[model samples]
Target: WFQQSESIIPNHLVSVPHPYVSIVKKCTPFPIEFVVRSYMTGSTSTSIWKNYQDGVRVYCGHTLPEGMKKNQKLASNIITPTTKEEDHDRPISAEDIIKEKWMTAEDWQV
Candidate 1:
C-alpha cells in the first residue's frame, strides 16, 4: 500500500518494515478528525440514526429534519468531528471545541 501510494504521489514514503511506515516529512497535528456522513445507521446506540429516533434533532451540529428513518440518507452531508483517543475515538462538536478553546474561531472556520 505504501509503495502504491508513493507511485501515485512521490516524496511521502519512508523506509520501514511491512505494515509499518512513516511519512518522509513531519506534519502538523490536527485537534480533530472531520467526518462527513451521508446516511444514518442505527448500528450503535449512540449513532446518529438512534439519536434521531430518540428525539435528538441536533447532533454534532447538524439539525436533522423530521420523518427520517433508519439507514436513511440525510438531506445533505453532515460534518461530525471526533478526536483520536487511546482506546477509542470520541465524538466532539465544533461549537464545543471553540467554546472550550481547543481551537480558535478562525482555525475552526478553516
Candidate 2:
C-alpha cells in the first residue's frame, strides 16, 4: 500500500495567456509582400519562371516582360500583398487596401 503526503498550502497558481494572441500581433498585416528572386533553378525558382511562360505576367505584382533570360535578375523588386483572412490582410494593388479603409494606411505601409 502507498500513501501520499498533503501540502500545507497549495502550490502557487501561475496564469499564462493564450500564445495565439502574441502570434497574431506579431503577424500584423502589411500592404506589400516583397519577393526577391536571385536566379532560376530547378526547384521552386523554376516554378516562378514557368508561371511567366504561362502568361502569368506578374509574380507577386512585379511584372515580367517577354523573352527574359533564365537566371537573369528582375529589373526591380516585387511587392505582393497578403490575403485579408491570413492576417489583417488584403489583396495586392487593391486601391482600398492601399488606401486602408480597414486599418490605418501608415501601418500597411510597413
Candidate 3:
C-alpha cells in the first residue's frame, strides 16, 4: 500500500523494524484534518449520522438536506474539518479555521 501511494503522497518510511513496526522520519503535522465523506454514516459522536440524527442540519460547514437516511450516499462528497487535538478532536468549520488562524485562507485555497 505504501509503495502504491508513494506517487500520491510523501511518506515518512525510514526502515522496517518488524512486520508490525517501522521507524519513520519525524515531521511536523498540521493542526487540522479534513474528512471527506461520500456517505452519511459513522460510528463516532462527531459523525455526520449522529449529528443528523440529533436534528443538526449543519455539520462543520456543510448543510445537510432533510430526509437523509443513515448510510445513504450523498449526491456529492463533503469535507468535514476537525481540530487535531490529542485528547479528543472536535468538529470545526473552514471559516472558523481561517478566522482562528489555524490555517490561512491562501492555504485553504489550495
Candidate 4:
C-alpha cells in the first residue's frame, strides 16, 4: 500500500476528510489574479503611471489615469492577469492587454 505525501500536494489544492467531503461540493476553474501597484521608482507603478501620462491609456484595454506622481498612490489600483510563465510576468496596462487579446473586454469591465 502507498500513502500520499504532503510535499507532493499542489499549492492550490484544498482537501477535506472523507467524512467531510460532500457530493454537493463543486470545483471550478477561476483563472484570474488581481495585481495592484502603489509605489513607483522601482516597482510596477512607474511604468503604469508613465503610460497613462503619455496618452497611452488602456493597456490591453484597461483605462488609467491621465497624470500621476512617481510615488503617489493611485486613485484606484488596476489588475494585470498574466500567464504562468516566469518570463511573461510583466505589468501591462488594461488597454494594451486587451488590445493584444491577452484579456477580453469583459475582463476589463471588472
Candidate 5:
C-alpha cells in the first residue's frame, strides 16, 4: 500500500517464501531515534515537564525559555533523540552523537 504513494519510502524486500516468512534488505540505522514533543508530559528525567520543573534551561539541543507550565505547548517543536538500549532508552544530544562518531555530519544533513 505504501509503495503506491510517491511520498513514502518503501523497504526493499529481499526474499519471500510464505506469508509468515519474508526478508528485507538490511539498512544502516541511526543510532538515535528522534522524538518530537509538542507538549510537556511524562515523568522521566528527559521529559520536558520534569526537566522544566528541575530548572533545566537546555534540553537535547533546544534551549527552553524560563517560566513554562506543565502540559503547556512549547514555543516550537523540540527534537529529543534517544539511544536505543536493551533496558532503557537514554536521552542524547545531536552534538554528542557527532562527537561520539555515532553519525557523521553529512549523514545527519539529510
Candidate 6:
C-alpha cells in the first residue's frame, strides 16, 4: 500500500517484523482525523448515526438530508473530521478547525 501511495502521501511504516509486531517511524501525528462514512451507522457518540438519531442534522461540516435510514448507504460519502487533542474526540467543522488555528489554512488544503 505504501509503495503505491508513496507518491501521494509519505508513510511512517519502517518494517513488518512478524504477523503481529512491526516497527514504525516516530512521526508526529496530526491532531485531526478525517472519517469517511458511506453508511449512516456507527456505535460511538461522535458517530453520525448517533447524532442523527438524536436529531442533529448538521454534523461536523455536512448537512444531512432528512429520512436517512439506519445502516443505509448515503447518497454520497461524507467526510467527518474530529479533534484528537482531548481525551474524547469531538466533532468539528473544517471552517472551525481553521478558525480555531488547530491547523493552518494552507495545511488544511493538503
Q: For this target, which candidate reaches the highest TM-score against the unseen true structure?
A: 6
Better of 4 and 5 by lDDT: 5
Tens digits of per-residue lDDT for model 6 on 1-90?
654676787778777778677688888677998999899999798999999999999999899999998999988988999999657999
- Give the root-mean-square deviation of each candidate in angstroms: 5.0, 14.5, 3.5, 9.6, 3.3, 3.0
Residue-wise C-alpha lDDT for candidate 5, range 1-110, written one tens digit per residue: 32354245545566567767767778877768888999877798667778778887777877888877888888778888878777887677889878877789876665
- Give all TM-scores, in the order shown: 0.63, 0.41, 0.73, 0.38, 0.73, 0.79
Off by over 4 Å in 1: 1-28, 85-90
Q: Which pairs of residues collide in model 6?
A: none
Reference-based TM-score, model 4: 0.38
Choose 2 or 5, whichever is better by TM-score.
Answer: 5
1-110 per-residue lDDT for model 3 (tens digits): 66567677777777777889888889766699889999999978888899899999989988989999999998899999989888998888999999988889987776
Candidate 6 ranges with C-alpha deviation above 4 Å: 10-27
List per-prediction Cα lDDT, in the order shown: 0.74, 0.47, 0.87, 0.50, 0.76, 0.88
Candidate 3 collision pairs: none
Candidate 3 TM-score to native: 0.73
What value of lDDT does candidate 5 attain over all alpha carbons?
A: 0.76
lDDT of 4 by residue, 1-110 (tens): 01244365323335545654623335443334455655432334335555555565664346655555667775655555543334555544556567767668885564
Q: What C-alpha lDDT, on a 0 to 100 scale, does residue 95 get in candidate 3? A: 96
TM-score of structure candidate 1: 0.63
Model 2 misplaced regions, further than 4 Å: 1-34, 40-47, 80-104
Worst 10 residues of 2 by lDDT: 1-10
